[model samples]
Structure formats: C-alpha cells, structure tokens
Target: MEHSKIISAAMKINQLTDLNTYVIDNSGEFVFYHEDISIPAFMPGSGQEDVLNLYNQMMIQQMNQLYSYTNEWGLHYLGYSFSTNDSFAVIIGPFMYLTPDMYGLSREYNLRNNESEDLRSMCNQIQVLKTDKANSFASILQQFELLINKEAVPIRIVANKDNEKYRKRENNSIMNDDADIVTMRYKLEGNIMHAVEQGDKTTAIKLLNSNDMLFSFSERFPNQPLRRVKNLAIVLSTLLRNAVIRSDVPAIFVHRVSEKYAYEIEYSNQLSKLQQLYEGMVEEYTDLVIANTLTHYSKVTQKVIEYLISFYDKQIDKNELAELCFTHPSHLSRKFKQETNMTITGYQQMIRMNQAKHLLKNENISIEEIAWLVGYEDASYFTRVFKKETGYTPSQYRENN
Candidate 1:
C-alpha cells in the first residue's frame, strides 16, 4: 500500500479511538503524527528526542510484529512494524493499564524534585484502560496492519524485568516505613491546601486525585467504604473552607459553599457521584477565592464589593449602598474608585459582564434570555456592551470559543 493511504487509514483509526497515533518511516523519521490525546509535557517519554530514540531502537529490532511496551512509570504504548517496499511503523500510546501510583512513578522517573501537585496533575491526564479494552484496541491495530500490509502480525509483549524488580524493591521499602506514609499524607494535605488558597484549581484537583496513599479509603476502612469516603469528603470540605478563609474570602460565602457540599457528600450514595463532588467542591471553593478574596481592600470597600457580587443581577442604589457601609454616597464612591480603580457602577457592570460571559460559555440560553439573566433589560444594549467589552459579540464569542 502507498504510504499516504496507510497514513490516511491511521488517521481514521486515531479519530475512532481518540488515541495518539504516529507513523515513522524506515529511517526512523516521523512521516506523520496525530494526537487526539496528548502526552503531558512533564512525563519521561513525552519529549521528541526520547520518542525518536525509542523508535530507532524499535526499527532496528524486527518487522511484521505488533509490540506492547509499558514504561517504568506504568505508561503503555503499542507499536507495529511492516514493509511497504520499505519498513514503516504505527505507534499508539501513553495510556495506562491501571491507575498509576504517583509516589512510585515519581521515584521511577526521578521526579521527586518536581512539585507533587504538578506530577499528579500530569498523571491524572493519562487514560486508563482495562485489559479487555487494551486487547480490543490492539486487535483493531492488528487488523489495520493486515489490511494495509497484507501480512498478519504477531503480538509481542516486551517485559521490562528491570523495572519490575525496581518497582517491587521500592514498594517493599516504602510500604514497610510507617513514618514515610505519615509524612507523605501530611505533605500532600498541605500542598492541596496551598493550591486551594492560591486559587489554583488545576493543581488543587490534581493533588486531590493524585496521592493514593492519602486518598485511598479501602485500606483504612476495609468494609465501610461509603462511610470512609464520606468521612474523607467531610475532612476535605473543612480543609478547603479554612484555606478559603485564609485567602480572605468572606466567611459567609465560604460557609454557603462548604455547607452545600457537606450536605451533598453525606446524602450522595454513588462513589462516582462523590468523586465528582470532590472535584466540584475544590472548584467552587477555589472560585470563591478568585471571585471574593478582598485582602487588599479596606473593610468598607470589601463590604461594598461583597454586596455588589451578591446582587450583581439586581439594580444598585448608591444611597442604599452608602447607608449599608455607614457612609455618604459621594465618599463611598470616591473610596471605591480609589481602592479598585473603577467607579461603583463600573465595577458592578464588570461583574455583570463577567457573569454574562460565564453564562455564554456554559449555559444554553438565548441571547435575550442571557441579557435578562445578567440584569440587562435590553438585549441590543447588552449586545453592544458585550461586544465593546470582549471585542467579539456574544454569538461570535460563543462560536469562536
């Protein structure tokens, strides 16, 4: 078969499977690469040099064979070689056979110097497949090979015995030390709290999902799985609440979001639902810090900002806001402008515009409805304001985004 036809077929398979696919020519140069799922930048084999080195090694070994290789970090890949007047190989990979242990992966990849949160964030992005699914994908690739090259390829699993030996040795050493486990748990918790306080949602959620030693409840509870998970959720909510408080978000805002998740965690029965709630709790709390943290403002300005945030959809009365802050309207206005570099009405509009953008991105409502939702009675006026603020009209923004 022609190389172009083979590349075209591989692209189709990539679309169908949503996996990263690559085609290397006989000289170990990349003829084509399609990435439906990307490998994280921090991983060991994600670099071009490392990939080409591996490809060169594979090309020298054999042809007309399907190969499965699992790296020391537990990331898996599939490769197949065949001749088409010359040799070519199809590579699919960076998936996992099982959920990876972050600690073990860190040791294997010499990634301990990297932030644990970042490592976990990268780890969480990898896809995990069951044995059957892995086999099924392999079979599809094999069939593609047979169709394109007109030769059947035998599947080969390359065993990394050295990696296995190292993993067992490291696991035994780490598992036997109780102090290391305790230290890891505390360090993980502190890192997650730090991520939350900084409003780093990506890092927070990744840290929450990363550390198996800290987050695994089965070993702690053995039997009462639901109770164990709920307990962990409750603890996480309290931790996030404190972190938000430290970020200078109002106690009322933190309480409302924390209380909501606390109730949801207790009543939720499904593990999957609870897992989602865990991420949601991190997101909402981190957003609270992003939206409401007022550490830099005066107490009066802080109160006014909080009021505007809570009532952005309603009409603002300057006199009423001044009364609430125990000040005259002119003084209140001047103070707000001094602190925030925008007039009170301007700040309110900014909040409304932000809310409108959020709705535009996440909600499936009409433009007019969105205008009403963001406190604009006139859809045309809202469109003009949105266009001025974002350079793109709402419809265009939605389409472009």
Candidate 2:
C-alpha cells in the first residue's frame, strides 16, 4: 500500500530524532504508531492522556491556522505537525529533561507485571533522554515545512481513471479562466474596497462569498495547483493594503497587518485554507477601518464619518448628516469637535484629502476628476481648499509628489 512509505518515514523520524511519532486520520484516530518506546514508559512520569493531549492539541491548532502547529508543554515537551496525505500526523516531542526528574517513574501496569521476568526486563530498559527544545523545534519546523509544500499523494490502492479525468477537468477549469474573469476580479475588488472604506461589513462579506477567484496556469507549472491561488492571495494582499491606506488607517497598522497576512499566504499550502484566509483578510481589514474611524467619535459623529467615507463622491451638508444621525446638526458638530479636536468640516476634508492623495499617486485621472472624486464640484474652488490644507494647489501637489 502507499501507506508503507509514510509509515517507514515516520518510524525513521522516531528513531533518529527520539520523538514519539504517530499518524492519525481526519477524525484523529491513530493509523500508525511507532515502536521506538514502550507505551507505558513513553513519556517518563506522564500517562497516555498527557502524551495524547499533545497530539490532540497539534491537530486542533493546525486545523485553525494555515501553517504547521507547534507548542511547548509540561515544561519539557514540544509538539509539531507534519504532512500526511492519508491522514494527519504530529511528532510529539523531544523531551528537554536533562535528568531523570520524575520521567523515570514506572507505569503502574509495568509494576503489576514485574513478577514476569520479560515484563520486568522491558520495564528496566526505560531511560530518560535529554534534548534541546529550541533546536528540536527548529529542525521539526524545517522538515515539516518541506513536507507540506510537496504536492499531496493520496493513500488509495489504485487510480479510478474516469474519476481522475473528471477531477483534472475540474481543476483545469479553475485555472484557465478567460476575459469575463478579469471583469469579475475588478468588480469584486472594487466592491470589497468600497464596502471596507464605508464600514459596510455586510456587503463586503457578501461580495467575498459571491466571488470564487479563478487562477491562471502555464504549461510548466500546470500541475502545481496552489501556485496561482497563492499568487492571487499576494495580489489581493497588495490591493487590500492600498485600500486600507486610502481609508485613512494608520500607516504602521496597515503595514504590519498586511505583512503578516502576506507572509502567511507565502507559507500556506492548502486551497481551503487559502480561501478561508482570503475572505478573512478582507473582513478583518474592513473591521480595522471601521474601528479606526469609530474611535473617540460619538455614535452620531461615527455615523457622519461613515457617510463621508461611503459617499465622498457627492456634496455633504451638516443638516443632512444630522438627520441621518437623528440629532441636531449643531449638537453633532459640537460633540465631533470636542471628541476629535477638529471641526466636522475639517475632519471630512481630511478624509477627502486622503482619498485624493491615493488617487493622485496611483491613478491617471485628471485633477478635476480627482476633485470630483473626493466630493468637490467646483474645480477652481477645490484648488483653493486644497491649498488651505496642504499649502499647495491640486496641480502643484500632483506635480511635486
């Protein structure tokens, strides 16, 4: 069976690394158990429950994140995940104990069978091994990282040719997208950007669900399924970062979160996880924008800012915003200034300016269009307003930057 190779590799890892190795199926039942150590004396003083908990924890953690799971336990244990196409597997530790330290305690079952010479002899063979946890974890991380990156091989006994052909067709359809794919990509990207900037979490999530990003494949890596999907994630990450900046989130916050997900995408090797991470990135980045805009502002002020972010293409009036907030314009204005230390006009203008900065830097749209893009109708008047804030007219600002 295909599983023989998997079992052999797992056992060799156990022998060479001194870690307890095992493979478990999707439902977390052990499929292969190594024989390097006797069950009763496997973890020194610890029982099966404590040892098994480490594997359980590894599965639980790996199921949540896109990468391999690893953690320290009981002051001496380190657990790490490995790839196994037939099932899940984790190598549960190189115990860092340098001395006997309670790890040499005999299991009760071993003591009960001591009258039998064979059982007593096996019990007497138990030894407490010392290891460096940091070095061991690093080694495990490297080995398993390579393992998960390889194309998965199934554990089935034989190929079903018809089923294989159908699956290949399905996979190719996902990759060889045509012209309409471009339109859908643009539409979804715009929808996501608009919803996040406006704090419209509902629409953003809906759009994310409605779109299943198709990928492009070349002749060389045609069989490498995850490559294009990973590339899509990187592109989405960069676009979302730009959207975040245009929404006026702090630059440092944007960079850190963007970089974090970018690295996660780089290291990730699963389609389901990539899809999950893609949706999560859009939703969470939008949440950050909403949170950043809502800070310190009253409920009314928050509503007003949300409106500005959503409809900055149109002129805004204080009375219209106050009606939406269910408060008098004067009351809203007073609270907005008190909370944010800026007049309502000043805050809205700052948002417009941020949008203008982004468009100017990234787009070939004209200055008049840029002003109109940020809610200004009169181009000449927009220039005076831009000068008042930035000490440069829109044209001058565009030229310098």
Candidate 3:
C-alpha cells in the first residue's frame, strides 16, 4: 500500500470518529498527525515524547499487531503497527475507559496548586467510554489496520498491567472491611451525582446500571423484595433530586419531578417497573439540569425564569414579578433581557407554547380549554399565538404531531 493512501485512510478515520490519529515512522517520529480534539498537554505521559516512546516499545516487541495502552491517569489509546515500503504505525486515542479521578490524579502526580484546576479542565475534555464502546473503538482500529496494512491483526491490549497493579494498590489501601464497602459505595454515588449535575445522562445511567450490586437492598430486606426495591428507588430518587438541585435547577421544577416519582415509586407493584423508574429518574433529572438550570443567570433573573416556568398557565404581572425579585419593573425587564435575551412576556409566552404543545399531545383537551389553561382568555388569540410560535394551529399541531 502507498504511504499517502495509509495517511488518507487514517485521516478519514479521525474525521469519522473524532479520535486523534497519528502515523509515526519506525524511528518514532510522527510522519502525519490528525487531531480532531485537542489532548491535554498536562496529562502525565500523554505528550509527543511519551507517544513516540510507546511506539518504540511496540516496535521492540516486534509484532505487527494492534495494541491498547491505558496510562496511570486512566487515559486509553490504540496503536497499530504496519509497513508500507517503510515501517510505520497508526495511533489513535487518549479516550477513557472510566471517568478520571481528579483527587487520585492530584495525589499521584503531586500536582502543584494551579495545576489541579488545569487537570480537572483537561479531564473533562477526554471522551469517557464504557467497556463495550471501548471495545467498539478497538474494532475501529482493527478496521483501520486492515485498510492500511491489507491484513487483519488481533487486538492485544497492553499497558493495562499497571492499571491492574494500581487497582490492587487502591484495594489494599482500604483499612477496614465495612468502611471499605461504605467508601466504595459513596464514591460510586458521588460519580453518579456528578455525572447527573453535568447533564451527562449516558454516563450517569451507565454508572447506575453497572454498579447495581453496590446499590442492592435485597440482602438487608431478605424475603421482602418489593419493599427492598421501593426503598432503593426512593434512595435513587433523592440522590438524583439533590444532583439536579446542585446544578441550580429551580426548586419548583425539581419538586414536581420528585413528587411525581415519589408517587410512582410507592404505587409501583412490580420490581421491573421500579427498575425502569430508576433510569427514568436519572434521565429526567439530568434533562432538568440541561434545560432548567439557572447557574449562569443572576439571582433576580433566575427567580424570574423560575416564576415563568412555574406559572406559565396564569396571567403574569411584571410589577408582581419585579416586587418578587426586589427590583423595579424596568430594571428587572432589562436584566432579564440581558441575561436571557427575551423579554419577560416573551419568556412567559415560550413557556406557554411549550405547555400548550404538551397538552395538545394528549388529544383529550379541546383548543379552548388549552387556551384557557395556558393563560390566554381569547381562544382565537391563543390560536394565533400558538400558530405564530410553532408555525401550526393548535388543532393542526395535535393532528400532525
């Protein structure tokens, strides 16, 4: 195969997967590099020198095979060695098999005061993949090797021996048996909450599903399976609620969701329903964080936004909102516009339209009822507003959607 063809294939793979790809000569120099996402410079042993050294190590092994490397920081990579007139290898990654442990990295790397923040920011930039997804990534590298080298090679995961040792060391560091379980459980819960707060529903749900044993209440309840499952569901609901609250989602929204789940958790008779509810809770709370979190808004603006969301079906008076936010009406309007890029009435209208659409989906509610329900007294006026906002009349939206 021509070297240019190999480079072109690697570039195509990089573009397709958004993973960094490199073609390095046998001399351990990069002949071509395609970086879609920037890898963090501060990550230990993730630099050019480290990459070249790892390639040399693979060369010394003298095997034209695909290899995986996971450094101490939990960053993963794939390498495939091949020859096209000259010896060369294609490298991909700096992806992750697990979320990076910021505290562990800070302790192990002896990061200076300012470097800890840099490490955290960098850790956020890396793609975290589950085991199956990581395996799929390995298969991508295999396909890339077949494209360039014209032969198939088995994926041999190397560089994870140290990872095993690190895990053993961590496991051995735990002092007491009961405390160890408690600590491990808290760590997993913390990870779930952090993922939820970031609106990472995939990571949060993945962590939750993968760590079911830690969350099992069966052992404690013995024969009472339904009671155990319901208790577990309630605990998970509380955790998700707190996570979204920490993300600065309005208390009203969080409370409504929490209450809805609370009712379902208690009323659910089957364990399967409870199991499904756990994922639902994570998904809804994460979506709340994504859609309703007001962390970036000023306090007054946050209050106004919350008010709009909670009372979109009722008539809104700017003076009342101004008084509620402890500011004059004009200042509140300006601040709200500056922060949200929408006037108070405009924001309220958006909320009304969203609610109107949701109600329209039910098909049981008439347009006039929905109009009254969403704060418009005149049904025709509500139809005009709904049509203007959605490019469909309420009845048309119900029929189409």
User: lDDT: which candidate is best?
Assistant: 3
Candidate numbers, best lDDT first, in rank order: 3, 1, 2
Query: So what's the TM-score on candidate 3?
Result: 0.43
Q: Can you give the TM-score per candidate against the true fold? A: 0.47, 0.43, 0.43
CA deviation > 4 Å runs, candidate 3: 36-43, 149-160, 163-401
Which candidate do you rate higher for lDDT, 2 or 3?
3
Clashes of 2: 0
Ranked candidates, highest TM-score first: 1, 2, 3
Off by over 4 Å in 1: 36-46, 101-118, 146-401
Compared with the true structure, all predictions reach lDDT values of 0.74, 0.59, 0.75
What local lDDT does model 2 show for residue 342? 88
lDDT of 1 by residue, 207-309 (tens): 7776644677467787888888888888889988998998888788988998799789979998779877888888999889967667679999988877876
| Candidate 1 whole-model C-alpha lDDT, 0 to 1 | 0.74
**What does candidate 1 score in Cα RMSD to the true structure?**
17.3
**Predictions: Cα RMSD each:** 17.3, 23.3, 18.8
